[model samples]
Target: MADIDAIVDDLDAERADLEQVVAGLDATLWRAPTPAQGLTIADQIAHLNWTDELVMRAIRNPEAFADEFEGVLAPAHAVESISAGSAIVNAGTVERSKVPQSQLLTMWRRSAAELSGILRALPSGTRIPWFAPRPLSAAAMAASRVMETWAHGQDVFDALALTRPPTGRLVHVVRLGVRSRDFAYQLRGLEPPQEEFRVELRAPDGGTWNWGPADAPGKVEGSALHFALIATQRLHRDDSDLVARGEGPEEWLRIAQAYAGPVGRGRERQRPLDAV
Candidate 1:
């Protein structure tokens, strides 16, 4: 059976963590641009607000995507494009920090509460929609939320240079990401390589590190944090402690993307993160 409550709890924990970071931000720091172009720290948080709300809306009306999902790549494309467009409009009109830090935190808290209520009220095993790799279950939706929140949380942490101990939760996404490796490559409009690569991630607790194809020779082993950081594209391949034992590692690293939807190259910033 899928663990529904646990997945929901992860979202709760994620919201609390986000509140901790944003509630205490210095105004100037909040205004600082994050890795995403044209989005400052505050804008990112606001975007999160919009997204979480949309997830609730999706739950309420699962058929919203039904009519327009007929064309090639229509489903995922429509969803992602609409989402990206919403953020653009918000950026153009909404203040990055719309509510005060305290109130913003409060608003998020309430918003998440609403989402939780909506989710709990849903029938389990509901066929929620997503693009590529097929439609997902309600449980899968929860997991995706965990991945989204955790990945974006990494952005806020990187902005503040605030480090938190790694969580085993991250390993789940890395494993899922590897399983979806073909989709990631396809998003780049490329065929996935047939040769599998060994993937190893050291657990935060120093337990057995888990990873990719068991029979593959070349191994990429690193701390769970590094694996998560790179998989989420928060850290560039070469910048993290990630090391490929041989050729396969480099090949895999070149197109790693933890998030779903169409794949895009990681942006190169004006200054190297290491240098800044």
Candidate 2:
């Protein structure tokens, strides 16, 4: 059985961390540009707040979400390429940018807390509507939300040259990264490698987390922070301490993406972290 309770707790913890940081920011800090081009810290929070509302809709009204999503994307689809999706996002964020920073932060906190409650209220094994190839269970949906919050929070932290300490919460992210291995390959139109790969990470609290077959020929071993960094595309694989043993695992690390959406143009290599 999925520890749905634990997933919700972790989600709340992730939200709390981000909320605390964002709440402390003044207007200048909120307006600072993140690592993502053309998006400020306010844009990140706006995006997350908007996404939380969408996730809630998916949870409570799947048909409505599907309808609204189609309408929102209809204009972009006419362009005939994936970049259209980016256009949709850019437009939405630009519109959301009108909201004041303090208001956006409040919206984020309330929406995130509401999302956690919705996830917790769902019965065991309830799958929610999502943009991923398949629907997600309540637990999976919560994990996805946590992953997004953490990754985007990293971007905000990087933009401000502030350190967001790693926590065991990232175990959720690394686990998602491992589970999405095949999805990552499929996103690039490549066949997923047939063999399983072991993934082992040293947690922030001196504990080890392992996934996949222990004796698998391929393996990814490293700090959870490194794995999460690459998986989120914030840091290139070479920039991290992750060691991938064997061709399959190496490739996985190189192209790993733990979130859904059209593939992102990852952070460029050799860029200074503070420069972001």
Best by TM-score: 2
On lDDT, the leading prediction is 2
Per-residue lDDT of 52 in model 1: 67
The 10 consecutive residues of candidate 1 with the worst lDDT sum are 66-75
Q: Report the lDDT tens digits of candidate 1 across residue range 67-110.
A: 33334224546435534544443553255357665666666677
lDDT of 2 by residue, 105-219 (tens): 7788898888888888998778775666567898888888889989988988899888988998898899899999998887787899998999989999999999999999999
Q: What's model 1's overall lDDT?
A: 0.67
Task: Name the TM-score of candidate 1.
Answer: 0.81
> What TM-score would each prediction reach against the true structure?
0.81, 0.90
Off by over 4 Å in 1: 68-103, 131-133, 209-212, 265-276
Query: Per-residue error at 80 for model 2, in Å?
Result: 9.3
- Alpha-carbon shift of residue 215 in model 2 (angstroms): 1.5
Residue 16 lDDT, candidate 2, scale 0-100: 82
Extract clashing residue pairs from model 2: none
